[model samples]
Target chain A: MSKKVLVLGETREGALRNVSFEAIAAAKKISGGGEVVAVLLGESVSDFGNELVAYGADRVITVEHPHLKSYTSDGYGQAFMAVVDQEQPEAIVFGHTAVGKDLSPKIASKLQTGLISDVTDIEGEGDDAVFIRPIYSGKAFEKVKLKEDGVVFVTVRPNNIAPLEREERSGDVSSLSVDITNLRTIIKNVVRKSAEGVDLSEAKVIIAGGRGVKSKEGFEPLQELADLLGGAVGASRGACDADYCDYSLQIGQTGKVVTPDLYIAAGISGAIQHMAGMSNSKVIVAINKDPEANIFKVADYGIVGDLFDVIPLLTEEFKKVM
Target chain B: MNIYVLVKRTFDTEEKLVVSGGQIQEDGAEFIINPYDEYAIEEAITVRDAHGGEVTVVTIGDEEAEKQLRTALAMGADKAVLINTEDDVEEMDQFTAAYILAEYLKDKEADLILAGNVAIDGGSGQVGPRVADLLDINYVTTITSLEIEGETVKIVRDIEGDAEELETSLPLLVTAQQGLNEPRYPSLPGIMKAKKKPLEELELDDLDIDEEDVEAKTETIEVYLPPKKEAGRILEGEIPSQVSELVSLLRSEAKVI
Candidate 1:
């Protein structure tokens, strides 16, 4: 039942993203006692091979090219296609990150195969891996299995799967040289809206706000509470539409889908679109002035009061406790 | 400029989904063009208006999908094409959808192809890039801004917490993200004009693709709703007392703190 699987290790800002390790864990699950090979692509990422091995990869393949130092659809697609052609893995896995979403489909088309994307769970064994993914913006879940026999491609949603415990395993590391050329789309620059913090999708704790926060400055207390809780700050689409925050912070049906362990909705009214993104969180806390607010319907704990009074008190209490 | 927009008919975002026997119940369900694809249709109309060309909206679905295609035409697309597969293909996934679409578009002399970043129903965000790859054309996804001059293209796409600027060229495919532009509603005149617009229907045989050739590569085993959450506990007390109780619950019961 064993089958070789390839895991594409993702990197951002010269550091390995947490999703990369999670992907290795997923690859190991369906690997069926076969080798799990991790593929790392960047300008200079050879040093991360040992870490990938420790995370349960049996071997690591590194592809270094200047064009890959930053992610471009062409560069990453070319690099991934080359590695896929060389390795010919029975199954390929990637974290459903920005890079993965952009590159996986391109590779799938080149290989004339199908890709089950944003998979939250994996079952079955060897070539019969069954992937569970959300459809209709998490309203329903679908279990999908690839029908093709030769090779399969999948991208796992971040934070859904647990990574393997670190162990000292002898893993072989090899280097691959791929000619990455004829780039049509070139990345000029990336403009970050906020300083680095817990990735919203992967955060265990999330403090989110909505139009009830009132103004751009109203999010300060929520941000402070989020930092204290070691979580990311998110906003509902209503907040983004009101120009209270950037759209990147918006969590809704049209925005990012997040499932944190602890989700605090301060002032969010819980529009269906907003709930679609975070309703699956393990626990939800709603703090709003409206007693009849829709957010309370999904919240495990509801405080019917003004967030202006509730958020600061919550932050203060959390500060004292932790 | 020959512009093409890919559209899909999906359940309205606000409709409650009900699963029966591993399939979604569509009876009396309100359907609309996938929300994100509205941005593509709007952008296609804008591009065609600015560059002196025609806009064609294409969709792959059953007869019911014609309503969504007509909606796109009413939104200003000059023409509409529906590739009905209700009888030919038993299962349809992103791969098969893209393959059929790519086969149809291969000879269309497309200068610009636009589609939604991802369909809300599927949320895969793959078809645009997949079609682009199959046609050996350039593509960008989650794009918030796009500018075209002659054969040069400038785009700004949404990343997680930021924006990425890129430069590409013509004969490119781009997926419309949320912030791209405000999609216009169909005007009274536009709606009436759409009634007379050329809405062509094609079967799998018309595209020279056998059902077996474009067979879905994935199969769905089951469909179910996420577990329901218990009712919320509303604490009754002064602000200070409620805060204390909440903290206690977090530390002892939830243990997330």
Candidate 2:
């Protein structure tokens, strides 16, 4: 049952994202006493190799090339394939992030293999493992497995897997020089809009708004409460469409799916589409004056009062308690 | 420019899913064009309009998928093709789907291809890049903005919540994420024109693809609904007291805080 699982350690701003380590954790679960070889590709990424090692990787392969500076499917795919050819891993794991979502499929196609994307949980072990992923957004769940075992490609959803605590161990780091070719897409530049803090997908708590939040300025209070609780601000599609917030903060069937520990839906009416994103939150608190709102139906705690009133009070009360 | 947009018919996200007999029951389900693909169809139409070319909408599904294809045509796609795999193949997954679609598109000489970032139903998001890979072309997924100047193209793709602005060329495939564009609803005249837009129906054999060549790589071990959550507890009385109790409960019962 021993299997060699290769994990792609994804990076952002010269550091390994938490999901990369989480993928290593997943690889450990499915590794079944086998080796976990982690690959990091970039123009410069020796730290990524050591970081993956600090978390959990039997060996590290740092695929470095100038074209790997930016994440183009062609560049990353070419570099990873070179590593794949050399290592001959039986399985591959990715974080299911923006880059992972875009790159994994192309790599799978090159390998002429099957890929299970956005897996939330892994059950069983090794070859017989089953992957659980959300279908219809988060409204339903399905268990899938590779039909015929060739090379198992999996992309694990962010925050769904447990991230390893950095143990800071020195692992075997081998630098790989790869030739990245087939130049197609060139990075012009990147625009950074995400607020620096708890990543929305991985946040422990979320304070979400809806169209009921009204103007763009109406999000100020929600942001305040989110900041107070060290959570992240989220928005329903209605809020995003109404120009109250950005689409990146939107959560629905068409947007990001999150499973936060505490979900505070302020003005959201809990549309089926929006519910598809957060119905799985561990504790949902609905603060709306309408007692019959659909959000209350799915909420674990409901306050039949305006969010503007309830949020500030809750923030103040938590301030005292904490 | 010659363009193709890949579309899928999926369960309407608004409707409640009914899973009976260990499979999702489709008898009473309401199906529509996948929402993300609406962005794809809309973007394809926009690209064709700006660049002066024809847009073809393609799908791989049963005869029931024809309705969704027509919907795309009504939205301004010039032609539609339904690759009916119902009689030819079974248990289609992302791999099989990309294979079938890539085969259908291999000879089309498409200058540009567009599809949804992910389907609302399966949510695999592998088909666009997979098809592009099979066609040996460049691809970008979850794209928010696109611009074309002759053979040169500029794209702004969503990377997490951030954006990566890139430059690529024609003969490129890009998946349409939400915020790419507001998809147009089929106008009355557009719908009328769509009825006569030469909807071609082809089987898998028409693409010269054997069933074994497009076999699905993954299998559904099980399908089930999410576990039901307990009913919510409504807090009444004064807002201040309610908030205090909520805080106390979080610390005592929920323990999340």
Candidate 3:
């Protein structure tokens, strides 16, 4: 008998995020003998439901409603509750992206279960399920034995698991209805960045700035360079706090984590707090006036210079080539 | 509105965490109330003070968490409940913790329960809503500001890019964000008074919590230091020369260009 695993396949702008596929891969690893079913909830999801099979879902449970055309916490949770009540799988997994972050807890609560959230590692083979989550903000990890239940809930951290290959298989897509009348909260609007480039979390190359960038105007050239290279712009806590950039751009212990192929630091002093976040990146480049800046400790290449002058030159050169 | 603030004690931020043998070495670590929980406690007290209702600080941890509970009591919470779990229990992993807490709150007659959106430690941000779910009440996380009118609770959450306003009924759960309020420091007088404040301690058995069902879903295979980053070679020469060399390196060697 196969263990039954349920996955909440998350999406944005009608397309499934890579993290959803990654979640499916993780579900495949831990499901044991269970069949993996992907739950895709949205408005008009018929066209998108077919993609789940290739991504390793043995079954696709799709909940389509006009209110769920876009992502809302209430719609997703109710749909999930309905699905869980119907399937009663051995394990339910979600991608710990923004959508899952909001949706998982609600569903878990409704089920009167514990949600192992933001787990970097998960393994369930024995009668008990085991999870590993960073404690004290990545300072430590706690190996947790989940509460005994017929079904377990987990939210996997994004980008931690690589997506498995697409097999030549298609699953059954079943439509389900959810009663969302009790949901009072509504999404008035969703604002997206107008910039056309790789997402910060998914970027292969990341050029970051910090307080050393000096001013907001200094970021224009860095943005230009990032745009030229189809990369993303990131910032250290100092830069976000200094008002040189927005908090959304912050990449550090208290901010976003970037593990791109190339991480270029412009004027970042590399505080330990900041390093805790992005130190996992494959390669690092540090450009700063103070040669002893801690960023060089992590950098694969160091260029001691002023960002104001260097960024413009670099941007122009990259632009000419592109 | 009558509010309940959930506080947690965590390893102080200053402590150098050394991961050894798949565990955190706490030989010289100091503990403090989680910074975010402070914000939650302070915000709850402020709301209670303004709205003319009681504020209670609740924690699900060992005796060490009582320090934070006492601190919350001194900061103006009317009462404190320390739900002491086993010493080895990991934070937020025990569904029994949330379940026991919800059961305790069920009798408190609270109009709202306030907690830090997420503990800085595990950063799971799930317990409050899970408790709310167990309690079968409405829930909202990441609330930056909370307003109560009549029987409705209005909350503003810092969502992606902007603040979103959510309205729930009384007896709702709210998880507060950092910007919610500035937590007050325990002054000399407050600290002195804190020692006199009543702290009720309840064991898991006292709360009638049966932990036979839930278990940890995942386990840590290993805990190791992140790979050490090798220092970079300092590029020599003038601004234009350095730029050219940087470009050359990025193109030929790093290949990120």
Candidate 4:
């Protein structure tokens, strides 16, 4: 039951994102002894093709166009459709990043195929691939299998799958030129809010604050701890609504859903909306004054004290250990 | 200008979902318009007001969903359409829903189409872009701001940790995101006016789509709640002592740090 699987490698700021390699590993799993081909679409991304091969791809197809230097739904969709038409892969895999979420559906609709998005795990069921994904804001899980037979599309969530180690597999690199035209929507520019930090969705550790953090200046202490741990800083909707932090840092049903290895909640009351986003974290630590805060119910460790007094002490203690 | 907004009836995110007999228990559940779609409805009304046009809200659900459509009408949508598939389609996935919507909209000649970035219940964020694809139109998702003039549109879309500005033209679709606008509540006067708003109900046959043509491409094998989190150990005593104890526990028990 071998099948040809195509993995779409994503790039940000001229470097391949880690999820691209993770997707290659996923492609290898579902390929079932068939070929796993990686597709890279961007400006001057051909140099990164060999890296994808080392991760797991059997071959790489690089498509470079000046119009693809940045991502637009139309431009990427056209390029992907061209690749699909040429390769005729039985299945296509993409990392469920912003680009993937924005582009995959357009391609799926053009091909008139079903797309299983944000898949965390995959299994073989009688020659068919079954995708496991979270629904209802991670409150429940659903196993979905495509009923149609032609070509299947899927987007894998980042950090869920482990990427393959570097191996000297000399995969052939091929060049492709696609005619991308008639784009109605054009990206003028990408305005970055912050220059560099741990990507919240992909971070291994996250220290999140709520309204109890007080003011925009109040997050300085939380940021210090997060930087010390090499983790990301996140906020509840209450914090975002209160303008204590940008909405980009918000984690809840209406914002980003994250599953980090370690999640520390400080000065936050655990509202269900907020818990729906991060309750899936491996180890949760709640630091709040209220012993009866709902966050303590989901936390693996709780500290019933004022965060202002507790966070600095915790940071100092961690400094001693690390 | 003819505007249409896609609305969905979903369970309130606050309610804890109960699973029984391999299906979610629906009785006694509080249903409301998917919170995100409220932005779409509100945006549509704003757009219609700026330009001389009418706003129509559409949903695919059973009779119970009419209440949500009425709510949308009360929120300022000029009309509402309920494509009830209660008996026709037993199980509907994103593909089926988008297919039916595209089929019905093929002849509507809508100048602008808006939907929520994703529904809270499913959270796939697929239907808006899928419908636009099926109709061979332009689409953008996670839009925080939108401006329309004549046939051109400008939008600011939300990305990972920032925003991107884009320019597009009419006959386009965009999914509403947070910060787009504050959705208004239904006023007493508006609720009374909603009673007379045009509300139409259709079925699969009305769209000339057979149940088999738009059959769900994916099947759900199971549905169950996530594992319940166990009670945690609460550190007691002085602040300094609690800090030391937490550090020890992190090293010995959790092993995260």
TM-score of chain A of each: 0.97, 0.96, 0.88, 0.96
Model 2 alpha-carbon miss at residue B111, Å: 0.1
How do the residues A1-322 of candidate 3 rate in per-residue lDDT, one tens digit apiece? Answer: 3578899887665577777888888788668756899998877776767777898889899888887865556667777888888988877889876677777877776666667787666666534446776666565566665545545778887666778887778679988888766665555444453244356776778889988888998888888878877788889989878889776677765566566778889999988878766776777888898988988888888888888888888776665565
Residue range A1-322, candidate 1, lDDT tens digits: 7778999998776678888899999898788889899999999999999999998999999999999878888998888888888888888898998888989999888878889999999887676679999999999999998876857789999888888898987899999999999999888988997547678888899999998999999999999889889899999998999999989898989989998889999999999989999998888999989999999999988899999999899999988877
- What's the lDDT for all of these models? 0.90, 0.89, 0.74, 0.89
Model 2 CA RMSD to the hidden true structure, in angstroms = 1.4
Q: Per-candidate TM vs. native?
A: 0.98, 0.98, 0.88, 0.97
Model 2: CA > 4 A from native: none
Off by over 4 Å in 1: none
**Top-lDDT candidate index:** 1
Q: A1-322 in candidate 4: lDDT tens per residue? A: 7889989998776678888998888887778788899999987899999989989899999889988888888788888888888999988899998898988888888777888899988887324668888888888888887876867788998878789898988989998999888878888988886426578888888999998999998888888888899999999999999999999898888888888889999988999999988988888999998888999999999999888888888889989999
Q: Score the docking of each candidate (DockQ).
A: 0.83, 0.84, 0.43, 0.79
Instruction: Give the per-residue lDDT of model 4 (tens digit) for B1-257.
Output: 89999999999887888998878788999999998999999999999899979999999999999999999999999999999999899888888999999999999999999999999988888999999999988999999999997778999998876899989999999999888999999999999999999999999999999999888877888888877766889888888998999988888898888
**How would you encode candidate 2's per-residue C-alpha lDDT over A1-322 as one tens digit per residue?**
8889999998776567888988999998788878899999888888668778889998999988888888888888888998999999999999988889989999899888899999999998887789999898887889998998788889998877887788978789998787777789889988777667677887889999998898899988888888988999999999999888889898878788888889999989998989989998889999887888999999988999888888888888888877
- Residue A218, candidate 4: C-alpha displacement in angstroms: 0.7
lDDT of 3 by residue, B125-199 (tens): 777877777777777777667877887667777553245665667877777764576678778888788788888
**Winner by DockQ:** 2
